[model samples]
Target: MPISSTRSSASRIPLLDILKGLACALIVGHHLVFYGPMSDVAYPLAPDLMDWLFAYGRMAVQVFLVLGGYLAASTLAPQGVARFDSPLQQVLRRFVRLSTPYLAALMFNLLAAELARYGMDDGSVPAEPSLPQLLAHVFLLQDLLGFEALSAGVWYVAIDFQLFVLAVAVLSLARFLSVRWKAPWLAPVLVLLGACASLFYFNLMPELDTWGVYFAGAYGMGMLAFWAGHSTRPYRWLVALATLGLATLALDFRGRIAVALVTALALGVLQASGGARHWSPMPALQRLGQMSYSVFLVHFPVCLLVNALFNQFWPTQPWANAAGMVIALALSLRAGQWLYQHVETRLVSMPMALRMQGGLLVATGLVLLGLKAL
Candidate 1:
């Protein structure tokens, strides 16, 4: 059999973007149903379909976490130590890339909420925000520290940020151990062992204030997939074993099966598609994939705004509610894609001096985790 090849390293592992986009869309639908008319302060009307979509919509976030782990692991490994840039620089880059858009979304949500109240109150002028905790919101620590999220969709960003830091450490350790052991495979093996330890720790002990273990495993798996894809003969056996494990996880054995299954499947996707691109003649999905972050961030506020506006006007039209939701989702995705291309893409490439900033972030995260334990 002829193995597939690609010009771009990213093209070799194509499923991730698709999965991420799917997750974001599911989240949008989920939030629409979740915070629709059922919410206490919801507008007087929302679509009846909200109840139906709620359950299915809830699965998107977890899927995203699993996907995050797989990608983090695959993307962070050094091409060569001699050509290796500092890991800290990479970490800082990730932080800024994720944070800038998140902050923008937060601001938009804040402004939208204020304007919403004004219009709802018959134009008497909106009340000021009592949720001043928006101050801590940008750091992605609010959710873990027991504060409500500053924006509706920010909890996942918090999760991603936490996972990113853990991933850096995990990859760094893998690199260090590889050098000490004098074997290339040693690093990957240690990473696998570490993943198992994390899975066990998170499942049984569960004492850490943060859920970094699971995230670490997932992101590390992604990195592994990336490596396997580049190899002449990838680890086909591991993929098979992971697939079986995933099937068992789907059976619900109450043994962190879901995590194992999700982790496995995520890696499997990367492994199988490692050499191939799921190309399409039509580019709609590629566009969606590109705008995924924006879609994920902006969807919540759109839903919230739609809910408020719909209730004020319709008061009880379920069909109209659904129609409005569809429209808002479409418009939100388009806007998100536009912003991502114009604003986020450029910001993502901004130079950060890697040595100090990335190292400090990794140390800070570890210190924070240790403090949580103590």
Candidate 2:
């Protein structure tokens, strides 16, 4: 079944937006204060009060991952009036919707980096990325090959993109399996597979980093929620299971188990909130959700620029760092609004075909590659 692009007519839940907004702000706060204080240039302690703040701050990224997966699945999965298209079409639509904003952001960040480099007098030449790496960024293939990260916060985008692909695959497989086998147990099996995968990645592949496995579980959980969202029955067992999962998270169980817990929590939230149909009225919260993506993308650069300026001019006062972060966040939020309104808004809704977007991506990659050779 094909999911419709047309948004549901239910009154949009402002709380979702608020959650997104706060989540984005948390990410900015994490990058600005948490990582900074941990680095040698900032804080010396790792697990003390400062360290604890950073640790908790980092969880904001995790929140975004969980929320994003939930939202993506909610929007993309087959639903009312959503025409069922081939898997290829599903994949293409995802690509187009995701990649366009990414491309715009990448270009903007690169240009900003270039400007920063030009203004610095430290005699440190910024290392120019290889053309291949640049192309990879444009194509959202950097993570697939373990290449360089593109934007400051783009690693999540890469994860999201990959999971989106997997979602399509999983949905198709689930549909096929349901037809051939028992239909009632398909969701449970998927939930089980996700649990297994999370454990395998968390325990066995500790070197793979928390971002990948964490987001994958979140995305899978989102898919689960999507499938169950339309159900009319009370899912008492599901609620109990999700509660157990969240307990694992609160207990500091990292990796697959933890990811599962977070995913479950997200599903629980959506369920409690009425599955996007009857979420409580929280206009401010809704605004946050709407700006969450912008917050995610814009914060890193803002912080980086602020740090650079601080390093160049003002002596490192903790007060200055605090002020810089506050200022950067305000500017970033304001800029995000403008960009979202003028650029992303227009581009997202344009009668743009995925094929053309693909071609432009290829051309952009080639151009970057040629620049590397120069």
Among these predictions, the greatest TM-score belongs to 2
- Encode model 2's per-residue lDDT on 1-374: one tens digit a residue: 12222433234445556666766776666666643221324453333644655666566665666665556555554242222458787777666666666666665565445545543433222245677887787667776667767566677777777776666666667667776785734543564476457643553455665245645655555554444443443255456457645654565566545644554555545654555555557766566568667656665555556556766665446565556556777877876776566545554432564554566556655665665566
Q: What is the lDDT, from 0 to 100, of the residue 313 in candidate 2?
A: 64
Off by over 4 Å in 2: 1-12, 34-50, 76-83, 118-126, 182-188, 200-204, 210-214, 226-229, 243-252, 255-263, 266-282, 347-374
Q: Local error of candidate 2 at 294, Å?
A: 2.1
- How many clashes in each candidate? 11, 15
| lDDT at 230, model 1 | 44
Candidate 2 Cα RMSD after full superposition onto the native fold (Å): 5.6
Across 1-374, the per-residue lDDT of candidate 1 in tens digits comes to 11224411454344556666676777777775566552423323443545545656655665666666555644565331112357788777788888767666665665555545633542222233344455456567775666766456676687788777766665677667667876555555655666556544553454653566644545445445544544445556456446544544454343334643564555454565534355443356656766788878776666567666766886566567667777778877876876587656763444442333344445644554554466
Q: What lDDT does candidate 2 reach at residue 256?
A: 42
User: lDDT scores for all predictions?
Assistant: 0.58, 0.57
